[model samples]
Target: MALYRGTGSGRLSRGLLLLLWVTLGSKLCPTGAIVQGANTSLAVPQNWTAHESATPDNKSQLPQFTLDDHYWLFAHFCWINFTIWMNNVTGAQLCDWRIISRPYSYLQYCLESAAEKLKFGYPNRIADDYIFKSHYIYFLNCTQDHPVLLDPPEDMLLALIIAPICLIPFLVTLVVCKSKDGKTQS
Candidate 1:
Protein backbone atom coordinates (compact mmCIF):
# COMPACT_ATOMS: atom_id res chain seq x y z
CA MET A 1 0.00 0.00 0.00
CA ALA A 2 2.90 2.35 0.73
CA LEU A 3 4.41 1.57 -2.66
CA TYR A 4 1.06 2.23 -4.31
CA ARG A 5 0.72 5.48 -2.43
CA GLY A 6 4.14 6.59 -3.56
CA THR A 7 3.37 5.77 -7.17
CA GLY A 8 0.05 7.61 -6.95
CA SER A 9 1.76 10.63 -5.44
CA GLY A 10 4.37 10.68 -8.16
CA ARG A 11 1.68 10.53 -10.81
CA LEU A 12 -0.23 13.27 -9.06
CA SER A 13 2.85 15.47 -9.00
CA ARG A 14 3.45 14.88 -12.68
CA GLY A 15 -0.17 15.68 -13.43
CA LEU A 16 -0.05 18.81 -11.32
CA LEU A 17 3.17 19.84 -12.98
CA LEU A 18 1.60 19.31 -16.35
CA LEU A 19 -1.43 21.32 -15.38
CA LEU A 20 0.80 24.06 -14.00
CA TRP A 21 2.85 24.07 -17.18
CA VAL A 22 -0.18 24.36 -19.41
CA THR A 23 -1.82 27.10 -17.39
CA LEU A 24 1.40 29.01 -16.88
CA GLY A 25 2.40 28.58 -20.46
CA SER A 26 -0.94 29.87 -21.68
CA LYS A 27 -0.80 32.80 -19.33
CA LEU A 28 2.83 33.57 -20.05
CA CYS A 29 2.82 32.73 -23.70
CA PRO A 30 2.27 35.75 -25.86
CA THR A 31 -1.29 35.61 -27.18
CA GLY A 32 -1.82 35.41 -30.93
CA ALA A 33 -3.40 38.84 -30.70
CA ILE A 34 0.04 40.06 -29.77
CA VAL A 35 0.93 39.57 -33.42
CA GLN A 36 -2.30 41.01 -34.81
CA GLY A 37 -2.28 44.69 -35.71
CA ALA A 38 -5.44 46.71 -35.19
CA ASN A 39 -6.91 48.28 -38.28
CA THR A 40 -8.84 51.14 -36.67
CA SER A 41 -7.67 53.92 -34.43
CA LEU A 42 -8.80 53.74 -30.80
CA ALA A 43 -10.99 56.36 -29.20
CA VAL A 44 -11.91 56.36 -25.56
CA PRO A 45 -15.30 54.68 -25.15
CA GLN A 46 -18.36 56.89 -24.60
CA ASN A 47 -18.72 58.27 -21.08
CA TRP A 48 -15.30 56.78 -20.44
CA THR A 49 -13.72 59.52 -22.54
CA ALA A 50 -14.81 62.10 -20.01
CA HIS A 51 -12.29 60.61 -17.64
CA GLU A 52 -9.57 60.22 -20.26
CA SER A 53 -6.99 62.83 -21.06
CA ALA A 54 -6.40 64.63 -24.31
CA THR A 55 -2.76 63.90 -23.60
CA PRO A 56 -1.57 61.46 -20.97
CA ASP A 57 2.10 61.60 -19.91
CA ASN A 58 2.43 59.19 -17.01
CA LYS A 59 -0.20 56.72 -15.82
CA SER A 60 -1.10 58.89 -12.85
CA GLN A 61 -1.57 62.08 -14.85
CA LEU A 62 -4.71 60.90 -16.58
CA PRO A 63 -8.00 60.56 -14.73
CA GLN A 64 -9.60 57.98 -17.00
CA PHE A 65 -6.38 56.40 -18.15
CA THR A 66 -5.67 54.59 -14.92
CA LEU A 67 -2.30 53.06 -14.12
CA ASP A 68 -4.23 49.81 -14.60
CA ASP A 69 -4.75 50.38 -18.31
CA HIS A 70 -1.07 50.74 -19.08
CA TYR A 71 -0.84 47.14 -20.23
CA TRP A 72 -2.15 48.19 -23.62
CA LEU A 73 0.52 50.86 -23.63
CA PHE A 74 3.21 48.30 -22.92
CA ALA A 75 1.77 46.01 -25.55
CA HIS A 76 2.09 48.92 -27.93
CA PHE A 77 5.76 49.14 -27.06
CA CYS A 78 6.31 45.43 -27.68
CA TRP A 79 4.44 45.62 -30.96
CA ILE A 80 6.67 48.50 -31.92
CA ASN A 81 9.82 46.59 -30.97
CA PHE A 82 8.61 43.50 -32.76
CA THR A 83 7.85 45.51 -35.88
CA ILE A 84 11.27 47.12 -35.71
CA TRP A 85 12.86 43.72 -35.38
CA MET A 86 10.81 42.38 -38.27
CA ASN A 87 12.20 45.26 -40.30
CA ASN A 88 15.66 43.89 -39.46
CA VAL A 89 16.73 46.29 -36.72
CA THR A 90 19.16 44.97 -34.12
CA GLY A 91 17.99 44.58 -30.52
CA ALA A 92 20.83 46.85 -29.45
CA GLN A 93 19.61 49.62 -31.69
CA LEU A 94 16.07 49.13 -30.38
CA CYS A 95 17.41 49.18 -26.83
CA ASP A 96 19.20 52.46 -27.54
CA TRP A 97 15.87 54.18 -27.03
CA ARG A 98 15.55 55.35 -23.42
CA ILE A 99 12.05 53.91 -23.26
CA ILE A 100 13.22 50.39 -24.18
CA SER A 101 16.24 50.63 -21.86
CA ARG A 102 15.67 47.79 -19.42
CA PRO A 103 14.97 44.43 -21.00
CA TYR A 104 11.19 43.78 -20.90
CA SER A 105 10.82 46.35 -18.11
CA TYR A 106 8.21 48.33 -20.00
CA LEU A 107 6.18 45.26 -20.81
CA GLN A 108 6.39 44.03 -17.22
CA TYR A 109 5.13 47.32 -15.90
CA CYS A 110 2.28 47.43 -18.38
CA LEU A 111 1.20 43.90 -17.55
CA GLU A 112 1.26 44.55 -13.81
CA SER A 113 -0.79 47.69 -14.20
CA ALA A 114 -3.23 46.02 -16.56
CA ALA A 115 -3.73 43.11 -14.17
CA GLU A 116 -4.90 45.52 -11.51
CA LYS A 117 -7.38 47.28 -13.80
CA LEU A 118 -8.75 44.17 -15.46
CA LYS A 119 -11.75 44.19 -13.15
CA PHE A 120 -12.85 47.76 -13.92
CA GLY A 121 -13.31 47.27 -17.66
CA TYR A 122 -11.71 50.68 -17.89
CA PRO A 123 -9.14 49.24 -20.21
CA ASN A 124 -11.66 48.66 -22.93
CA ARG A 125 -10.74 46.43 -25.87
CA ILE A 126 -10.43 49.57 -27.97
CA ALA A 127 -7.25 50.31 -26.08
CA ASP A 128 -5.69 47.34 -27.83
CA ASP A 129 -6.59 48.74 -31.21
CA TYR A 130 -5.23 52.11 -30.30
CA ILE A 131 -1.90 50.60 -29.35
CA PHE A 132 -1.56 48.77 -32.66
CA LYS A 133 -2.33 51.81 -34.73
CA SER A 134 0.14 53.94 -32.82
CA HIS A 135 2.86 51.35 -33.16
CA TYR A 136 2.31 50.99 -36.89
CA ILE A 137 2.53 54.71 -37.37
CA TYR A 138 5.66 55.03 -35.26
CA PHE A 139 7.38 52.19 -37.07
CA LEU A 140 6.79 53.78 -40.47
CA ASN A 141 7.96 57.16 -39.26
CA CYS A 142 11.18 55.78 -37.76
CA THR A 143 12.11 53.91 -40.91
CA GLN A 144 11.47 56.93 -43.06
CA ASP A 145 13.49 59.17 -40.77
CA HIS A 146 16.55 56.91 -40.51
CA PRO A 147 16.78 54.54 -43.44
CA VAL A 148 20.42 53.55 -42.96
CA LEU A 149 20.40 53.31 -39.18
CA LEU A 150 17.21 51.24 -39.18
CA ASP A 151 18.56 48.41 -41.26
CA PRO A 152 19.39 45.54 -38.88
CA PRO A 153 21.67 42.55 -39.49
CA GLU A 154 20.14 40.07 -37.08
CA ASP A 155 16.99 37.97 -37.43
CA MET A 156 14.10 39.15 -35.25
CA LEU A 157 12.52 35.71 -35.21
CA LEU A 158 15.66 34.26 -33.67
CA ALA A 159 15.56 36.68 -30.73
CA LEU A 160 11.84 35.96 -30.10
CA ILE A 161 12.63 32.23 -30.16
CA ILE A 162 15.18 32.66 -27.38
CA ALA A 163 12.93 34.69 -25.07
CA PRO A 164 10.38 32.01 -24.03
CA ILE A 165 13.01 29.29 -23.65
CA CYS A 166 14.80 31.51 -21.15
CA LEU A 167 11.54 32.16 -19.31
CA ILE A 168 10.44 28.52 -18.95
CA PRO A 169 12.69 27.61 -16.02
CA PHE A 170 11.55 30.57 -13.97
CA LEU A 171 7.96 29.56 -14.62
CA VAL A 172 8.73 26.00 -13.57
CA THR A 173 10.14 27.21 -10.28
CA LEU A 174 7.00 29.21 -9.62
CA VAL A 175 4.82 26.21 -10.30
CA VAL A 176 6.87 23.99 -8.00
CA CYS A 177 6.58 26.49 -5.21
CA LYS A 178 2.84 26.84 -5.67
CA SER A 179 2.26 23.10 -5.79
CA LYS A 180 4.21 22.47 -2.61
CA ASP A 181 2.18 25.01 -0.70
CA GLY A 182 -1.21 24.16 -2.24
CA LYS A 183 -1.65 21.01 -0.18
CA THR A 184 -2.34 21.04 3.56
CA GLN A 185 0.28 19.56 5.92
CA SER A 186 -0.87 16.76 8.20
Candidate 2:
Protein backbone atom coordinates (compact mmCIF):
# COMPACT_ATOMS: atom_id res chain seq x y z
CA MET A 1 0.00 0.00 0.00
CA ALA A 2 1.16 3.49 -0.82
CA LEU A 3 1.91 5.62 2.25
CA TYR A 4 1.83 8.78 0.15
CA ARG A 5 -0.72 9.28 -2.60
CA GLY A 6 -0.76 11.50 -5.78
CA THR A 7 2.23 13.71 -6.40
CA GLY A 8 2.97 13.95 -2.63
CA SER A 9 2.77 17.73 -3.05
CA GLY A 10 0.43 18.43 -0.15
CA ARG A 11 1.97 19.87 3.06
CA LEU A 12 -0.43 17.73 5.12
CA SER A 13 0.81 14.53 3.50
CA ARG A 14 4.45 15.51 3.93
CA GLY A 15 3.88 16.41 7.58
CA LEU A 16 2.08 13.13 8.18
CA LEU A 17 4.89 11.16 6.55
CA LEU A 18 7.49 13.00 8.59
CA LEU A 19 5.57 12.40 11.80
CA LEU A 20 5.17 8.72 11.05
CA TRP A 21 8.84 8.35 10.17
CA VAL A 22 9.98 10.05 13.34
CA THR A 23 7.67 8.02 15.55
CA LEU A 24 8.55 4.65 14.02
CA GLY A 25 12.19 5.40 13.18
CA SER A 26 13.21 6.29 16.71
CA LYS A 27 12.52 2.76 17.97
CA LEU A 28 14.86 1.28 15.40
CA CYS A 29 17.70 3.60 16.38
CA PRO A 30 19.17 3.04 19.83
CA THR A 31 21.31 5.73 21.47
CA GLY A 32 24.93 5.28 22.56
CA ALA A 33 23.99 6.12 26.16
CA ILE A 34 21.76 3.07 26.36
CA VAL A 35 24.57 0.95 24.93
CA GLN A 36 27.00 2.28 27.52
CA GLY A 37 24.43 1.69 30.22
CA ALA A 38 24.08 -1.91 29.06
CA ASN A 39 27.73 -2.46 29.93
CA THR A 40 27.31 -1.27 33.52
CA SER A 41 28.51 -3.88 35.96
CA LEU A 42 25.89 -5.68 38.06
CA ALA A 43 27.81 -7.43 40.77
CA VAL A 44 25.61 -9.72 42.82
CA PRO A 45 26.04 -9.00 46.51
CA GLN A 46 27.77 -11.62 48.56
CA ASN A 47 25.38 -14.18 50.00
CA TRP A 48 22.65 -12.67 47.86
CA THR A 49 20.46 -15.69 48.50
CA ALA A 50 20.58 -14.88 52.22
CA HIS A 51 17.18 -13.26 51.87
CA GLU A 52 15.75 -16.58 50.81
CA SER A 53 17.32 -18.58 53.63
CA ALA A 54 17.95 -16.13 56.44
CA THR A 55 16.73 -16.73 59.96
CA PRO A 56 14.83 -14.04 61.88
CA ASP A 57 17.99 -12.96 63.67
CA ASN A 58 19.80 -12.14 60.39
CA LYS A 59 16.92 -10.87 58.30
CA SER A 60 17.93 -7.23 58.47
CA GLN A 61 20.58 -7.29 55.74
CA LEU A 62 18.87 -7.90 52.47
CA PRO A 63 20.90 -7.47 49.30
CA GLN A 64 20.57 -4.06 47.69
CA PHE A 65 19.80 -3.65 43.98
CA THR A 66 21.40 -0.61 42.39
CA LEU A 67 21.38 0.66 38.81
CA ASP A 68 22.17 4.03 37.23
CA ASP A 69 19.42 6.01 35.52
CA HIS A 70 20.67 5.29 32.03
CA TYR A 71 20.85 1.55 32.77
CA TRP A 72 17.35 1.72 34.13
CA LEU A 73 16.18 3.37 30.91
CA PHE A 74 17.88 0.61 28.94
CA ALA A 75 16.08 -1.97 31.03
CA HIS A 76 12.78 -0.23 30.36
CA PHE A 77 13.41 -0.16 26.62
CA CYS A 78 14.50 -3.79 26.63
CA TRP A 79 11.38 -4.80 28.50
CA ILE A 80 9.05 -2.88 26.19
CA ASN A 81 10.76 -4.16 23.06
CA PHE A 82 10.68 -7.73 24.36
CA THR A 83 6.97 -7.53 25.02
CA ILE A 84 6.35 -6.09 21.57
CA TRP A 85 8.49 -8.71 19.86
CA MET A 86 6.82 -11.57 21.70
CA ASN A 87 3.35 -10.25 20.96
CA ASN A 88 4.19 -9.98 17.27
CA VAL A 89 5.61 -13.51 17.13
CA THR A 90 2.73 -15.08 19.05
CA GLY A 91 0.05 -12.95 17.41
CA ALA A 92 -1.29 -12.27 20.89
CA GLN A 93 -0.36 -10.38 24.01
CA LEU A 94 1.49 -12.94 26.10
CA CYS A 95 2.54 -10.33 28.61
CA ASP A 96 1.53 -6.79 29.47
CA TRP A 97 3.79 -3.81 28.71
CA ARG A 98 5.31 -1.76 31.53
CA ILE A 99 6.08 1.74 30.27
CA ILE A 100 6.38 3.92 33.34
CA SER A 101 9.43 6.12 33.73
CA ARG A 102 11.00 5.79 37.16
CA PRO A 103 14.34 5.35 38.84
CA TYR A 104 15.98 1.96 39.27
CA SER A 105 15.64 2.27 43.03
CA TYR A 106 11.91 2.66 42.59
CA LEU A 107 11.81 -0.42 40.44
CA GLN A 108 13.72 -2.34 43.10
CA TYR A 109 11.39 -1.11 45.81
CA CYS A 110 8.34 -2.12 43.80
CA LEU A 111 9.69 -5.59 43.11
CA GLU A 112 10.70 -6.10 46.74
CA SER A 113 7.32 -4.88 47.94
CA ALA A 114 5.53 -7.26 45.59
CA ALA A 115 7.79 -10.09 46.68
CA GLU A 116 6.88 -9.47 50.31
CA LYS A 117 3.21 -9.49 49.43
CA LEU A 118 3.49 -12.72 47.51
CA LYS A 119 5.49 -14.27 50.31
CA PHE A 120 3.24 -13.27 53.18
CA GLY A 121 0.01 -11.58 52.14
CA TYR A 122 -1.36 -13.76 49.37
CA PRO A 123 0.85 -16.80 49.02
CA ASN A 124 -1.80 -18.73 47.16
CA ARG A 125 -1.94 -16.11 44.43
CA ILE A 126 1.68 -16.76 43.40
CA ALA A 127 2.11 -18.96 40.39
CA ASP A 128 4.05 -22.24 40.49
CA ASP A 129 7.52 -22.10 38.88
CA TYR A 130 7.09 -18.36 39.11
CA ILE A 131 10.84 -17.71 39.09
CA PHE A 132 11.37 -18.91 35.55
CA LYS A 133 14.01 -17.01 33.57
CA SER A 134 13.21 -14.21 31.15
CA HIS A 135 15.01 -11.20 29.69
CA TYR A 136 12.95 -8.71 31.69
CA ILE A 137 13.45 -10.57 34.92
CA TYR A 138 17.16 -11.17 34.30
CA PHE A 139 17.95 -7.65 33.14
CA LEU A 140 16.10 -6.18 36.09
CA ASN A 141 17.70 -8.70 38.47
CA CYS A 142 14.28 -9.18 40.03
CA THR A 143 13.94 -12.93 39.96
CA GLN A 144 12.19 -12.95 43.33
CA ASP A 145 9.40 -10.83 41.92
CA HIS A 146 7.47 -13.77 40.58
CA PRO A 147 4.23 -13.46 38.71
CA VAL A 148 1.35 -12.87 41.08
CA LEU A 149 -2.35 -13.56 40.49
CA LEU A 150 -1.40 -15.16 37.20
CA ASP A 151 -1.75 -18.93 37.34
CA PRO A 152 -0.62 -20.12 33.95
CA PRO A 153 -1.50 -23.62 32.76
CA GLU A 154 0.74 -26.50 33.85
CA ASP A 155 3.37 -27.26 31.22
CA MET A 156 3.94 -30.88 32.20
CA LEU A 157 0.25 -31.72 32.30
CA LEU A 158 -0.30 -30.13 28.91
CA ALA A 159 2.61 -32.03 27.43
CA LEU A 160 1.39 -35.30 28.89
CA ILE A 161 -2.11 -34.80 27.49
CA ILE A 162 -0.87 -33.84 24.04
CA ALA A 163 1.74 -36.61 23.84
CA PRO A 164 -0.73 -39.49 23.67
CA ILE A 165 -2.97 -37.61 21.28
CA CYS A 166 0.00 -37.20 18.96
CA LEU A 167 1.21 -40.82 19.24
CA ILE A 168 -2.13 -42.64 18.94
CA PRO A 169 -2.60 -42.09 15.20
CA PHE A 170 0.92 -43.26 14.37
CA LEU A 171 0.63 -46.30 16.59
CA VAL A 172 -2.72 -47.25 15.07
CA THR A 173 -1.32 -46.90 11.58
CA LEU A 174 1.62 -49.17 12.42
CA VAL A 175 -0.62 -51.83 13.93
CA VAL A 176 -2.99 -51.78 10.93
CA CYS A 177 -0.07 -52.10 8.52
CA LYS A 178 1.33 -55.07 10.41
CA SER A 179 -2.09 -56.78 10.41
CA LYS A 180 -2.46 -56.27 6.68
CA ASP A 181 0.98 -57.76 6.04
CA GLY A 182 0.20 -60.78 8.19
CA LYS A 183 -3.10 -61.42 6.42
CA THR A 184 -1.57 -61.11 2.96
CA GLN A 185 1.23 -63.49 3.79
CA SER A 186 -1.12 -66.06 5.31
Q: Please tell me which predicted candidate would have the highest lDDT against the true structure.
A: 1
Compared with the true structure, all predictions reach lDDT values of: 0.43, 0.37
The reply for model 2, stretches above 4 Å from the true place, is: 1-67, 91-186
TM-scores of the models, in the given order? 0.23, 0.17
Candidate 2 per-residue lDDT over residues 1-186, each given as its tens digit = 122223424533643464344223323222231221122322322222223444547746443333332233233333333232233332122232352223233433433454454343322122111212233433343334465666456997789889999999999999888998666663
List candidate 1 stretches off by more than 4 Å.
1-42, 48-108, 120-124, 142-186
lDDT, residue 139, model 2: 38
Model 2 vs. true fold: TM: 0.17
Instruction: Specify the poorest-scoring 10-residue window by lDDT in model 2.
Output: 122-131
Tell me, what's the RMSD of every candidate?
29.6, 21.6
Estimate, for each residue in 117-172, the C-alpha lDDT of model 1 and write its tens digit. Answer: 55434344544554445455433344334445463446886777789999999999
* lDDT over C-alpha atoms for residue 34 of model 1: 29
Q: Distance from true position, residue 86, model 1, in Å?
A: 20
CA-RMSD of model 2: 21.6
